[model samples]
Target: MAKIAYILLCHKDPEAIIQQAEQLTAAGDFMSIHFDASAKSESFAMIRDALEDNPNVTFAHKRIKCGWGEWSLVQATLYAIEAAIADFPRATHFYMLSGDCMAVKTAEYAHQFLDDNETDFIESFDFFESDWIKIGMKEERLIYRHFFNERTHKSLFYWAIELQKRLGFKRRIPGDVQVQIGSQWWCLRRRTIESILDFIRSRKDVIRFFRTTWIPDETFFQTLVRHLVPENEIDTRTLTFLMFTDYGMPVTFHNDHYDLLLSQDFLFARKISPDAKTLKARLGKLYSSRGIDFQISNEGRSLYKFLATQGRAGRRFGMRFWETESSLGRERELMIVVCKKWHVAKRLTDQIRQETEIPAIDFIFDEDNTALPDLGGIQSSLAKRARHRRSLMRMLFEYFESDRLIVCMDPSNLDLMHDFFSDRSMTRLLRIECDFTDDYLIGHARRIGLAGDRTSQLTLERLLPTIRNDINHEADRIRDAGFSRHFRIRQSDSTETNATKLVEFLSLPYETALKLAQTRQLFDD
Candidate 1:
């Protein structure tokens, strides 16, 4: 039988740790926990008293004050490992876990899996050659001596790094050990663990170098295990399921993640929220159940890879493949109903919707009422609304098979209008220019109370010409960008505007166009 010892590094929430300890030890496994020195003294005392009577549970003798992306994490982990090894001499493997981690499968299954595979499970790859550092400093991490925690003192940390760079100062790796980077979690066989400890004890200079290195916890064990163990004995994958956001923060599992956790084959998953009571309770029950059916499957592993790929290069960043371009409205006929006045645009869109069987929507950026074709949820911010508008245009084609659709927009939103005008392949622009005289605009502003006082009213009055000029300028730009036709409807000649010309430009059937033209309210000022 395989006996596994767990080393848990925790900073907060003693009750949660106590619960995890009880569940993990139910299968006759040993647990060694290290509480961060920075955590409240009461939290540490509470956990120690709760588990003091349990023979399988031990606490680290040395506690370190840990900070994000600092060397203290590595020290805390080392203490936990030392305590586990000293107490559980019969243990076959040592698994590193965070307090947030919970068993996704029965402990018996995890022990059997570890026994069957003698190789150490960890993620280790050459740091200098790999593309792991996507967002921040890469080689400088190893070369520069960092004295500050980047998360807590970002400005000072970066300033020190810059100062070192300008002075041509650099640190050297103490030994011939190759630098490897990976996730901090790992499951190591006893021999491998012993080898890593022996190496650490013998190398004082190595400790000095990594003491100030950025995020050494993730790198220290990874780099040493490669040097100490044979290549074939090391598996460059963690047994724990973990994921990070685009911002490089860990994705915490919550109460709703019960099904999500059940589907994973990994023995444990980490960064569970403290408030995930339901998820922890259910998984905890399943953890110690003797007859719980647990089968090893690749589905969860496959899902992790799929989600990671999508997160890095998906539509969130506006990335799309050429093969799918035609499906995103590249080949479909699109009509843009452009106008500055909200009421006029809404009325025209309603008239078109009444006249045609095809989908016609209006005012995606409307202040009071946003119109979506197949999507819902009114965005509250201007930036979000603009992004949704863009998504609406792209996704609309995939949802509908109609030959044409009408999208009414207010060009007053220059941010959205300019983006629409840049693409000119299959889109037609129908512009409505309201010819408001100076007297009419001034009187209208006053009647609507556009501003409070005389000076403010005068400012609103002066803004009228600028708005008209911007609309006219955009029309010229759109025409120059190769949009085939521009149908301008003015208040003076609204009735005389040729209906047939408008119908041809929009690629609408004559009957539908006739009905649309007959709706005199569409052209009414």
Candidate 2:
């Protein structure tokens, strides 16, 4: 009978917190909530009244004014943890959670897993050796004292660091304890939590050092769990499934991510979208029910890996282009039309559609950098569309499933266009203006919303001369690759003729196109 006490650090969304508290208590678990002191008193009152009847629920004795990357986060957690321990004497384990977090797995499974493993589930590694510190100062985070809030007073915080660095002032660890860094989310056994509390009560110097340490919440408990718990009884991983973006922001789970979250071995997931009523309800239902036994699935791992490495090596070199939603066995001709001018692309696409049966889509990457208008039904966050550009191209290939598909790409997507330059499976046609004019450059910049200010326009004016050379070089590179031919469409060249030539080029297979490109004029412009 391993009962768990869930200590939740909440700042906002009182209803969501109440829902979580009810779900956990119904599953036979105790909850201790630490509401931020800065939050509205009305909201806290609402939560208090909602859970007043629930005997398994308790509020922190003291409310802490929490701030991001500040010591107050750890203070809030400690307050809740203390309250949980005092109230839930029968609880054998303590799990840390946020207001946004929801249980992805049932409590029965969690209790069983904890009972069988008999270890603390936390992420802990040597602070110096850890690559987990993706953003901000690493060694400096420990060496320099951070008095200002990192998020709110970013300038002052960095200024203080620089001042300390220039003064050659550094703080030393109070004790012989090893410094560790890890995710703030953790689940510790009762004995381990007690040991941590005991360490805190005894070590005043260590507490003082951590008080000024930058982002101590991520390090404080992570480091102490290592020194307090026996190495053999510690599992260096979190039971909470948390994923961050390329920009180091937490990924918010939504209704569509329910299946993905359910596949994980994690007990809970955080940063759930507040408007995700269906996701919250479904996950709440899972809290009390005997959900599927925990087992790591390869597909689940791959999905998480794909998301984790978005805009990185996972999607690098168009690796995910063919893998994502592509029908491999089906035969289809994919033609990517690369052009610098949107008007020219639209004209070419209009001509192609009127003259041939090929599906020619223009401006795939528009103002929002989204493919939704061109290829409907696949809605994604603006960040994903911009970051994972190749994923959108793959989706285009998969969605249409037409025998012949032509996608009109703007010069802004030059990186994506270059990715398919060498791939012989698809046919690529390049239409670029080698002669750079002030009007043309200015117009292009305006279209892309880059020339909003005179400074940016002046900057573009300076880079105008090299733009012609870059396009010519890319055209030569395509010719050299021998995989595709670059067709230059001048203003004098007839759009109808170029469209006909493109139609003929698209009709040929990769081998035929390669041979035609090398020998005779497959594209006449």
Shift of residue 287 alpha carbon in model 2, Å: 1.0
| Model 1 steric clash pairs | none
Every candidate's lDDT: 0.73, 0.71
TM-score of each: 0.59, 0.60
* Candidate 2 vs. true structure, TM-score: 0.60
Q: How far is 173's C-alpha from truth in model 1 (Å)?
A: 2.1
Per-residue lDDT for 337-431 in model 1, tens only? 87766677777677776665566767756554453322333234445556555445555543443556677776655555556545543667777
lDDT of 2 by residue, 372-460 (tens): 32233233454555455444555445444345577777555556556655344455565644344677766655655756556565588
Best by lDDT: 1
Q: Clash pairs of candidate 2?
A: none
Least well predicted 10-residue stretch by lDDT in candidate 1: 315-324
